[model samples]
Each structure stands twice: as C-alpha cells, then as structure tokens.
Target: MARPRTPLLSPDRIRDAALTLIDAQGLAALSMRRLADTLGVQPSSLYSHYATKDEVLDAVANRVVREVDTSGFARGWRDGLLIWARSYHSVLVAHPNCAPVIASGTQRREQFLEMANSVHGGLVGAGWPARRATEISGAVKYLVIGAASTPFGSGFADDVQVYLDRYPHLSQAHRLRHEANRIDHDSFELGLTSLIRGLEPGPGQTE
Candidate 1:
C-alpha cells in the first residue's frame, strides 16, 4: 500500500474531534488516550498536532469564539452589544458542555481576546470611557455566562406538589421545566434587553 500522501491527523481534525468528545461526554471525559481511541490513532499522533490536552481544549474554545458575530458593532454600540450578547448566549447554549472553558475569563486565546477587543473598542468608540467600557464588557460577559450556565426553567422540580406544599409562591414553577426552552429563551431576552437598557448612557452622562 502506497503510503498516504497526507498524514491522518491535522489540527482541524483534532479540534473537531476534541469538541465532539467534549460536547457529548464533557470536559472531564477528554484525555489524550481517549481522544486517540476516538480518532483511531495512536496517542502519540495527537501530541504531534497538539502539545497537551489543554492546547486541544484551547483550540475548541477558539472555534466557539470564532462563531460569535462581532460585526454588529457597525450599527452602533447598543445594537451591536445586544447582537453580540445574543450571539454569545446562543453559541454557549448550543455547547453547554463547553461553558466552563468559555466562561473561565482567563483565556489568552486569539479569537477570545479578539472578541473582547471588539466589544471594548465599540463601546469606547461610542463615547464610553475606557474604564466604563471595560466594566461593560465584563458585566455583559457575566450576564451571558450566567444565563447560559444552566437551563433556568428546568432547574425547578417537575412535580407541582414540590412547590405547592412548602412554596405557595411557586405553584406554577413546576410547569417551568415543561416549557424550559421557551421560558429560558424569553427570560434571556428579557434580561439582555433590560441590562442593555440600563447600561445605556443617560442625559449628560460623561466620563
């Protein structure tokens, strides 16, 4: 058999496989050995493409960050930020397993840093002071991360009695999980809109 001209491993392939493993089995399930098994390659092969598991996870984070749409800034800070928040939330929701890595807030990954830079720049360019711009960026990040941290409605017990007996205020809480999808989405939108509005500049507000 002629040796295949191309190596079986590549960065893209490694990143994609890593993400798939994380998405299904979660971050803890990712190991060089398991990844090799998943890829049907020797463990050493992964080392050639990635120095360590952390590097592979970083690649996955980059992939996620790259999907966020920062172009909304062209419209203006408010609109751009709302779009950015929604986009970030949507991406995190789709890859809930990756939330920890994405929300770590300590990444120096290229795409993540670029996303941060775009937000800060947009705010500053729109007249927010540098200090306030940083705060806004971080605040918005926290909001999105919190919203995507878990399924809000699903957190409640499904049994109506669970709330009714001890928590009269939560009589309808049991139904929340049944409508987790819509409730979580609508709740995120409500929070996002309110947060953005609150962050909006006021009359005579200046640095």
Candidate 2:
C-alpha cells in the first residue's frame, strides 16, 4: 500500500514557501505550481489556501511587513518612525526580489492598519494635528520605500564614477568623498533624521 500523505501544509506554510522562492529566484519565478513543487505537494492544493497568484503575492508582501518588529519603536513617535523605517528598509534590502511586490500591494491588512494607527496616535499625542500627522507619516513611508528601492551592486560605485566622469559637475561632487570608504547606513540615518526634523513644529505651536 502507498504511504499516507502528510498534512503539514497551511496558509502560513504556503506563504513562507513563496517568500523563500522570491528571495532565492525573484518574484517573477513564483507560481502556484512552482510553490507546490517546492513544498512537495500537488499544485491544486495551494488553491485551497490562496485563490490566485495575486493573493499569494499579497501574502508575501504582508509576510515581509510582518517581519518588522514594532515593539522597539513603541516608546515615542519620532523614535518609532525611525525604527520602523530602518527595520523595513533592512528587510526590503535583504530581499530586493520582493521589494516590487511590497511597493505595489495595498496595506489593507488589519495588523498593518493597527501599526499605522499606533504610529499616528503617537504623532497626535506629540502635538501634531490629525491631518498633518497623517501627511507626515505618508511622507516618511514614501522616503523609506524610495530609499529601499535604490539598486546597489558590487560594481555600482565604478559605474557611478564612470557616469560621473561624463558630467563634470557630478564628478566634482564624487571626488569629495572617499570612494574606498562607504557609509551607506550613515547616509540612511542622515536622510531619516532630516525628514523627522522637517516634521517638527516651529516656534510656538499648539496641539
């Protein structure tokens, strides 16, 4: 007689497999059949969990977002925003293949909205008006996503130098920096700090 099949598959497991595939082979390589093959299951079994590829992609995006630990940022608004941005950026950079999926998916998940509301509440408590708080949060998110999407390869510096050589003004700016020493994290910190500073109230302001 044939051996009985294992019942280890779940929505979470399927999503995990999908994320792994994305990290290893890029999002374009993710398909129901492909995922099933990776999981050692029948392709049709995935439909019982995720209805379509789009749904799978959405789950993958959510998985990436879920990787961000908000506990460390719960202390204050500014600190929370910075922590979230850095954490999110790190996750996206580590999984660049899934970055595009994250960029396109709508953050409609309850957990996601709860996190947003928590951040928004912090800003509101810190003397920011409701509408302005929302706008500032949106701006920070845009900056984080934009920065995470930047492409940096092993040859990126050489390529950038070559391009700058064609533009005298750019070359001048590039020459000021020590190309042998890179501080990408410092650059991210500066940008994040500047953005937070821009959101601060000037002079006397009322809540």
Clashes of 1: 0
Can you write out model 2's per-residue Cα lDDT over 4-42, one digit (the tens) per residue?
386657889999899999999887898888999998888
The digit string of per-residue lDDT tens for model 1 on 60-125 reads 999988999887877878888899999999999889889888877365899989999999988887
Residue 187 alpha-carbon offset, candidate 2, angstroms:
3.3
Per-prediction TM-score to the true structure, in the order listed? 0.87, 0.79
- Model 2 / residue 191 / CA error / Å: 1.3
Worst 10 residues of 2 by lDDT: 150-159
- Ten residues in sequence with the least summed lDDT for candidate 1: 198-207
Q: Which segments of candidate 2 are over 4 A away from where they belong?
A: 1-5, 72-74, 154-165, 169-184, 202-207
